[model samples]
Target chain A: MVKKKFAETPNFTIRKDFRPLDVKEKGLVFVGYEISDDKKTMNQFLHYDQLYTIRHGWNSPFFIGLLEGKIMGTRCPKCGDTWVPPRTHCWNLDCNLQRTEWIEMPKKAKVHTWTVAGWSGRSSLKRLPIILVYGVIEGSKTAIANELHGVNPWDVEFNMPLKVVFKPKEQRIGAITDWHFEPADEWEPSPMNKEKERIKKLVEPVYEWVKTLK
Target chain B: MSRKVCIIGGATTPFDYGPTGFESIEGGAAECVREVMRDIPDFNLRDIDMMIYSHFSVHFGHQLSAEWIIHDHLGLVGVPHYRVENGGNTGGSALYAAALAVKSGQHDVVGVIGWETMDSVSQSQGSEFIALASDIRYELMVGGIYPIYYAAMANKWMRENKVTEEDVALIAVKNRNNAMDNPKAQWYRNEHRYITVDDVLNSRLISYPIKKYDCCLMTRGVAFLLVTTEEYAKKVNPDHYVTIDGMGLSSCTIRAGDRLNFPGWIERYGPGYPEMTEFAACRQSAEVAYKQAGIDNPLKQIDFGEIHDAFSTSEAQIYKALGLADSENIAQFIRDKETYLEGSIPMNPGGGLMGYGHPVGATGLMSAIEAYYQLAGLIPKKHLSSKTQVPDPHTGIVNSHAGTGTSISNFILRRV
Candidate 1:
């Protein structure tokens, strides 16, 4: 009879010997999700210079006007509603809201609510410094999420007065460029959001824990 | 417990695993059924009475593959045919279902068939498809693979007492060597000896504790059995017959995610997770089998047998669950070569799903076939290097479990 091998390969083997290992006691699931160490065999590695064409239209001055500290938005002459960040089309389904106006307005709004992430992979924000906020401008509001700087993440409250703060270009990524909400130092927050009770009951504890990283 | 059902007739196609370029699943199933029909000159195809088909990947023919296509393929069109899908346990469940129908007097004779094809579809997809047997919300959604299913057993089994991955590897090596004697097995790829524990440790990781080698390969093939009463058996095959002596089915947690924690599950099932536990879906089938057969102490009373070694861990647990391993010296049992074809209780003598090529429906029936052979002394004894071989003592059993956690069927086949 020919000697056939059914279970012997470096990558795929079944041990016949009766020795043991202490792997299972560690409480770690045997398979790792991420390939932990770079086991690439060949030496060439990847290069980055081949892709820069998409970065050219990045920071035009018209886009920089908001960073220059003046109020900015896209205005509709018909409904008198101010839209910022200038979307190309209107969301008004009733009257065909389209991108038809460019206008300027005040930069202030009131904070509706916030949350701070308690955990992170990096030693970031000193203490959980990220904040998610719902801000209302003249007649309209949109929820914007960003990291809170300078102030404590846990101290943020609903209905606190706020203004947009844009970081310097040298430290920013070109996409979703720097712009976050900051609270006015003296204005205390009013508990007025619609889901304020549930929000307070659920989210604030996490927010407080996050503030300690700083 | 109820009276045992017997296999009057059975058939097989050349073990087609679809992508293996053998016959397709339906073609293989039809061939097996046709072979059975040929053996039983008096039995009529239209009078199949009821139908139970098993499948790993129905691909498109899930229910209709064995039922619709098989009916058309074998020329038995109008009878009701239902497909059984339970991952690796389907074959065992298929046989159990057919047995139950025969015992219930639902039909004079029922055909149980199963098949699987892994070469055409990607292994990950095939596995992901079977992973559906686990709870979607918690365990699977968390990216747990099949080996992890048994790895948890390996972990707890080790913590509670002592069983290592190497012990599992020893079982794997044994199964592979056993498959060498079986031309019907799926592990024709390599010799199991000479492999070391370090090899299993270094294999590609799928889930912690489960490496690529620690898992079974997905093969393509079809297998089936015909179940009926003693009267029907006498009518179909008057000369050859094997009765269900001590069958047992136990349920385990089908989906592990729903429970508050995992340990709550083992409390009901005992050693082999849900397969032996009251929580398992196949509990009724097992109870009826053990009671009808009058087997109160399975470990001591029953002799050599086969089981659902979907993973090597399962084999170990069943060793204890059935009370065979003696617990005090299980390692000595394996190292001394006790659990082999000549061991005190030889399990999965057909190579098990680990090496037999787990093609769903065919696995359980295949185990049944092995049981029938062992009962009749058809199997070549322990392969003493191919040329030298001899037979061993009698009394055999085959335990199979499916993915559903509910479909477990343990079969006890004996020679008169």
Candidate 2:
């Protein structure tokens, strides 16, 4: 009981009339931590994603331009630079101006970087495959994330020419990417693998932490 | 131009999650400004000097590439303005930037407004998107989400200090009750009546130690603050005011993934380590504000105010960091209800981010505005009319955290 409580939320000490170290066997390699209610410890694990907790911005395109396969980052008038995912101010450290004009992101660009994801179970996606990437676009200060189709994750070469493809409007989820990435070639787009993303999201973290245990 | 600035006026709209957008945040900005104008009756919006517009979800609003969409809609077009984004800290950073603008003598009257609409995005994607704000190269790129970070922090706190998971729950119960008096709060009256420590310990795991009650609900809203100089304060009403006493902003590494001593919430207590995004942020930011206000003992000196209690774990760290209660002994403070709005140092009179809503972009200024009203005794009857009401809580401070280990600011407001 004494040890498990401590393991649950580690770092700060509470003042207690009964010190945990006083009565327990101190040196059994966390014999103290295992003192918590073993059956109940697992019960404390929570699912914050569900039961309506925190959520962020939508993914679908806000304007017609994005739905029509346009890169629509904002452009600041004071700096007169075009922001691909448009911005209200010049993010330039020195120039501080709001009120930007919307501009089209240059479609013709090379792949800056890429990651392949195998699907995990979630809404509409069941072990589906997907590719996520970021790169320099013409006239944009920041790189944006988009879905990559048609090419294998291993085949995703750097600086390769690619064009944006809007997802079917019915498939939109109000996210930044109502559209995803597609090879400039009109060949069949790959159905994203969700397994890789699942491993990245679920397994990698505990795996890394456990390595330090020994 | 000394290294100091003053708030001239401020504004906000009723907060909700996602149902509101940039237009609504803009609308809140408009309403808050209109309220400020009504209160001042002298300074006109057109007469204000410059502006900084902040929004964390402009992309979701589909207004990402066009800040002008809201900038122009807000009617402050031709003067001077820029959009600001620092993930979650954009709101406070906006005020911090506005303060810099004032001290630099760049803008005489600056309107700093932040807004967000989260429902605009689907939930699963929201987690990944927010996760992106961390050191994505290392943190998000690997798959750690926000609560995981907090869970890591909670893990650290429990390990170092002889504390229990129930301690984290106590914070949630206390904060939600605090939200009851807050008309603008989102989770003011939770359905789970009379939650207990055992209940918290048995709840579903969100990265562990972070139960459902321990986390905050999502909501939409906008907040605005107008700031100027002490001289300018005399021009705006002079009496019902709160000066920017000692404002300090800093950013730190929020990812525990990087530190061997990641559990060092107690160990990493140091100077010049600015705003902290972790639960520790409230404490660090409070330390700066307390020092600036010449407050040697925050619990005894500074009056009650609001903070970014985005998670119950965060409030635990804030209370401990602020010295309102020792980390281990925090559960007692909740029983005393000393941190509530009607308690010894009424906290979250506006219900905080947990109750009111966590709009990310507008949070900082809203915390400041709540402090402003508390100090000015300008609280509405709803917050004051409750069984929990102790009437006016004057002279307070507002502290909030932003982004992946980005910036935190502490503002002290006093009734003039």
Candidate 3:
């Protein structure tokens, strides 16, 4: 397969602007400028508006499996260690970077730990009060992180059983968000503890505050 | 054996500079360099044999190869120099590298200059840039910002250790209150010089268990430290210097999830241990440093500590890692005021990252500078106040961590 040139890619774009601003402070200059020998030319801010084209490279199979409604992981042939969010090579010093083989991971997992995020990076700010969890899938030695949904954030619990829920085929983008975790058939949130109650009290107000911003 | 390395002098710009603190990175760095030169007797730029630049991300300033520009501006262009980038550990890692250079006899006197100008972008944009430091493919995709990542650990740790939200808030209160005595602390410039634990509990939530006050300020500032061999240190300032007794650096998996049921968790920490909640790298780093420093009991042997409290939760976790407190006694440790300036094994008397602004590259070096000043008994003279100084401190430890303890460096400094 041939890759498109960056110039021809749909995600590539450039933004340019030039404006003068007041420089009142003796030493605080907004932009750094360099002049030519003849003092004619100068330089200022330049902006690049482009989306990165990051390839999965050796981990392509893992992403490919996501779109196919299956979770893929890597297994070390030498040591029999399994990894989700798969690695191309074994990380163990004993294995010595041996090439790893792909294996289909079980859809079920147990919540190792979690947090209810009231704020996030700019892109995910709108999805406030998001539940993020690190889940250890069955038959895998390591855990993978993803969003947890279908249950109230306050109701999330440790060691909760969960099953992977993939986005519809048309909505799939081969990204990690292509799937998320939801409560398994037999799982239920336990009664709230004092520690969790405190978190709930702190986080509830944030939801209201976020609504005001929106 | 490597030659002994000592920090003879150090200086830092006020952390409240905000973004656009100076005309350029060079301008900010030059100010710090000049301050260090003036602060240390008979010391000047000419004394710096090599320079290690600690800078975190190029995304902030949109500039690459910034170390060269700062190097040229400092009039040390001919000297060997390179930049070190390790997320939040940039400062400590750079200092570690500089110490090695001095210890190996490659350079008798080394300078570690660290700075970050983060106000170039809005807070949200800055958060986005910082989140990119995580494993972008897995963690960042799931909306994992620093606060959220730390909050996850906080939740598990708090529940297991029986630590309350109020207990975590006490850290914010202690650090910020301590900051009032620090002229360079960001909190020192705040309208409200002191905040109560209730205020922290009521503060807006960034992520569950991590409130607004619990977070460190995204700052623009610079810190400089002069590390040299015993000969050079004695030559410059014989009366005021701290010897680098022990330094240890360690790293772990960048992805927090991978630590779950970690390979050696049960063997190392005992059965039924919550692995991801603890900072294993921090413990490993401190273990190495303590061993080398001949410290059998850190809480009793070390006089004080300047910890990497990127979040209040991290500080609590680090207390256990540094052997200051254990899981069962951590909450009680904070409640009993064991971590305050006047307590046994006082922690962060100079205001930690929470109260002191956190300019990623400069933060670790700032902690080292505080350790140096405290050990040398220069707090009252240099900071213009004795409120934040530990009494007759002979040993102090500085910890710098990055990426959810993905990388951690611990240094034990001794009054010489």
* Model 3 agreement with the true structure over A1-214: per-residue lDDT tens digits: 9976765433526322222354233432345556768875554544444435676777878877987888999999998989897888887666888999999998999998888888888778878889998899998877788899999888888899999999999777777999999999998778888766877787788778778875
Across B58-158, the per-residue lDDT of candidate 2 in tens digits comes to 44554454456556767876978887877667777788788788878767777787777665566656666667677543235323356655554554455
Q: Please give the DockQ score of every candidate, comma-separated.
A: 0.02, 0.02, 0.52
lDDT of 3 by residue, B217-305 (tens): 88888888899999988887999989989899988778887776555555566754437788888888899999989998998899999
In model 3, where do residues sit more than 4 Å from their true spots?
A1-46, A191-197, B17-23, B264-274
Q: What are the fnat scores of the candidates, in the order listed?
A: 0.00, 0.01, 0.78
Fnat of model 1, as a fraction: 0.00
- Model 3 has an lDDT value of 0.84
Measured by lDDT, the strongest candidate is 3
Show model 2 residue runs off by greater than 4 Å: A1-214, B1-4, B18-25, B141-144, B188-203, B260-284, B327-335, B381-394, B403-406
Clashing pairs in 3: none
- What lDDT tens digits, residue by residue, belong to model 1 across residues B65-173? 4456665676656777787766666777777778878888777778777766554444545666666666442234222245544443344444344565567777777
lDDT score of residue A145 within candidate 3: 85
Ranking by lDDT: 3, 2, 1
> Higher DockQ: candidate 1 or 2?
2
Q: Report lDDT (Cα) of residue B48, candidate 3.
A: 83
* Fraction of native Cα-Cα interface contacts (under 8 Å, chains A and B) also present in model 3: 0.78
lDDT of each: 0.55, 0.59, 0.84
